[model samples]
Target: MFPNEWLWRNKLIALLVLVIVIELVLFLVPWERF
Candidate 1:
């Protein structure tokens, strides 16, 4: 609920982004048929 806490949260954001990328590359996108 605090903006300052979020603003200083670099590791959380990096982990979030890494998780999103892994999901997209491993489980979501069907890149083989293209």
Candidate 2:
């Protein structure tokens, strides 16, 4: 049970980081063509 909880937390953190990186990329790059 402890291992499962730890994995879940890691997954959540990874997802959050991925979202932040995506947001940063969008902010830095111009999307006028899209």
The C-alpha TM-scores of every prediction are: 0.53, 0.81
lDDT of 2 by residue, 1-34 (tens): 5788899999999999999999999998888968
lDDT of 2 at 30: 88
Q: Quick one: best lDDT, which candidate?
A: 2
Give every collision pair in model 1.
none
User: Model 2, poorest ten-residue lDDT window?
Assistant: 1-10
Question: In angstroms, what RMSD does candidate 2 have relative to the true structure?
Answer: 2.0
RMSD, one per candidate, in order:
4.4, 2.0
**Structure candidate 2, residue pairs in collision:** none
